[model samples]
Every structure is written in C-alpha cells, then in structure tokens.
Target: MLIGTPTEFGAALERRRRELSLTQDDVASAIGVNRRVIGELERGKGSVRIEIALAVAQAVGLDVDLSART
Candidate 1:
C-alpha cells in the first residue's frame, strides 16, 4: 500500500526532529517557514501544501521521497 498524507508525514517529521534534538522553530527556520506552520503540521491540521510538507521533511532530516514503482 502506498500511503501518503501531510498529517502522517508531518508526525514523522516531528518525530525525526525530536530524535535529532531539534525544535519546531529550528525546523521552521531551516525551511524558511514560521513555527506555527510546524505546529499546525504536527497536529495534522491538513491545510499545508505537499511541497511545504516535503520542505519540512527535508529540513527535519525525515525521509520524504517515495518509492512508488512497484
């Protein structure tokens, strides 16, 4: 199953950030976004764009790429 959602990905991103000792502000700064964006994402608000989510994943060192070729 190919499962992808901003909320799920965002939660993963948050987990990775914490594992790396990074705060929401840290990720926001690295991704050029506001801390609220990170908070909203982590909470699964579901209004953020996919590109932004990818940016968050990258900034937080989370694996964002998909291996869709099955």
Candidate 2:
C-alpha cells in the first residue's frame, strides 16, 4: 500500500496486526516498547518516533519501502 500519511501508516499497521492475530501487547513485548506506545502509533499520533513506529511495523510483519514519486 502507498502510505502517504501517519494515519495511513497506522491503519496499515493495525490491519496487519489483526490479520496476524497479534495484540498490541504482543507487538510491544516483542519490540521492547510500552503497550501505550503501540496504541499511540496505531492511532496515528504524529509524535511517535520513526524508529519505534518502524519497529512496530517490523514486529507485525510489515515492510516499508521507499521509492521516488513518479
């Protein structure tokens, strides 16, 4: 999916997490982050650190690819 906004990223993460049958706590524990952080990221909180957000995506089996706009 082409995610252009924080909200889109968060929604994708949440959808993948659900598809994988993972709870927020499961992702948090795997990534060594607070559960609340997961919630915040899933809610599209713009303040979420990019590293941490990416970590959550990784934990949920999501990949972020960067490409130049055509």
Candidate 3:
C-alpha cells in the first residue's frame, strides 16, 4: 500500500504487527519505548519523534521509501 499520510502509515504498521503476531507491548519492548507510545503510533499521532518512528518501522520490517510527492 502507498503510505501518503501518517494515519495511513500507522494502519500499515498495525497490519504488519498483526501479521507477525506482535502486540504493541512486544513491539515497544523491542524498540525501547513504552507501550503508550506504540498505542499513540497506531492511532496516528503526529507528535511522535522521527527517530522513534523510524525505529518502529524497522522493527516491523518496513522499508520506507521517500521520493518526490507526485
């Protein structure tokens, strides 16, 4: 899926986690974050730090591609 917005990216992360049988807590533990942060991420909270966001994405095996928005 094409992730165009934070909400869309959050949904994709949720789907990937589910597919991998990982709970929010599990992901948080792996990424050195609290479960609430994971919850916020799943809810598409825009205030999340980029470093944390990138770490979360990497933890879930997501490869982000940034390019011209067109």
Candidate 4:
C-alpha cells in the first residue's frame, strides 16, 4: 500500500469510489457536502480538513485504520 501524501491516498480513494459505482455527487451527499468537494479531493487537493476527509471515508464505506504498517 502507498502512504505519505494526498496523491497516494487520493488515488486509492478515487479508485475505490469508482469501483463501487459511486459518483462525486452521491459521495458528497453521503458525506454531507457538495459534489465539488469530492471533485477537489479526487484531484488530490490536500487543503481539505481531516474531519471532512473522515466523513468522506465513512461515506465511501472505507474504515480508517490507524495501526502502524510493517
């Protein structure tokens, strides 16, 4: 798995979202935001706040595991 910056994380998130057949608008509603928010995130914009990111993750059915990886 990749780590470090928004590119890796954002790419993974976008891929998963697409795999699930979800549009930016769908995810935005589930996460309580506008479609533009998801678009910005998919574009790998790191200006997003962590809380919003977490909400997006939740909306996408992705769990945030904070355990250290080996």
Candidate 5:
C-alpha cells in the first residue's frame, strides 16, 4: 500500500499484526522495544523515531520501499 502519512503506516502495521496473530507485546519483544512504544507507533504518534518505526514495520513483515513521486 502507498502510505502517505504516519497514521496510514500505523494502520497498516496494526492490520498486518492482526493478520499474523501477533499481539503488541509480541511485536515489541521481537523488536526489543517497550510495549508502550508499540502502542504509540500503532496510534501513529508522529514523535516515533524512524529507526524504531522501521524496526516495528520489519517485525510485522512489512517492507518499506521509498520511490520518487512520478
């Protein structure tokens, strides 16, 4: 999906996690972050660090591809 904002990314992450049967804690443990962090990320908190967000995305089996706008 073409995620245009942090909110969009978070929604996608949440959906994928549910699809994979993973709890927020499960994703947090897998990425070595606090469960609260996962919660914040899922809520699309703009303050979330890019590295952590990317890590969470990977943990949930999401690949982020950046391309120039056409």
Candidate 6:
C-alpha cells in the first residue's frame, strides 16, 4: 500500500500486527526497539525514524517501497 502520511502508515502497521497476532512488545523485540516506540508508531508519531519504521514493517512481513517525491 502507498503510505501518504504517518497516520496511514501507523494504522496499517497496527492492523498487520493484529493480523499476525503479535503485540507491541513482540514487534519491538523483533525490530530491536522498545514498546513505547511501537506505541508511538501505532499512533502515527511522525518523529519515528525511517529506518526504525522500515524495520517494524519488515518484522511484520510488510514490504515497503519508498519512492522519490516529485
């Protein structure tokens, strides 16, 4: 899916997490982050690092494609 905003990314992440039956802590551990970070990501916190967010997506089996902005 094309993520146009942080909120969209967060919601998608949360939904994927639920579909996998994984918790915030589980994703955090998988991505080498803390639960709070996961919470923030789930809440659409725009400050989340791109690398970390990508890691979270990877951990949850989501493929991300970051295209160049025109």
Question: Could you tell me which residue pairs clash in candidate 6?
Answer: none
Task: Write the residue-wise lDDT of candidate 3 on 5-70 in tens digits.
Answer: 788888999999999999999999999999999988888999989888889999999988888878
Candidate lDDT values, in order? 0.79, 0.93, 0.90, 0.81, 0.93, 0.94
**Model 4 bad stretches (over 4 Å):** none
Q: Model 1, range 1-70, lDDT digits (tens) per residue? A: 2336666666777778899999999888988889998899898878987778879877776664567566
lDDT value, candidate 3, whole model: 0.90
| Candidate with maximal lDDT | 6
| C-alpha TM-scores of all predictions | 0.79, 0.97, 0.92, 0.85, 0.96, 0.90
Model 5 lDDT per residue over 1-70, tens place? 8999888989999999999999999999998989999989889899999999999989988999999999
Lowest lDDT block of 10, candidate 6: 61-70
Clash tally for model 6: 0
Worst 10 residues of 1 by lDDT: 1-10
* Best of the two (2, 4) by lDDT: 2
Which residues of candidate 3, in runs, are more than 4 Å off?
none
Off by over 4 Å in 6: 67-70
lDDT per residue (tens digit) for residues 10-33 in model 2:
999999999999999999999998
The residue-by-residue lDDT of candidate 4 on 1-70, one tens digit each, is 6457786677777888998999988898887888888888877899987888778877787787777769
- How many steric overlaps are in each model, in order? 0, 0, 0, 0, 0, 0
CA displacement after TM-score superposition, residue 37 of candidate 1 (Å) = 0.3
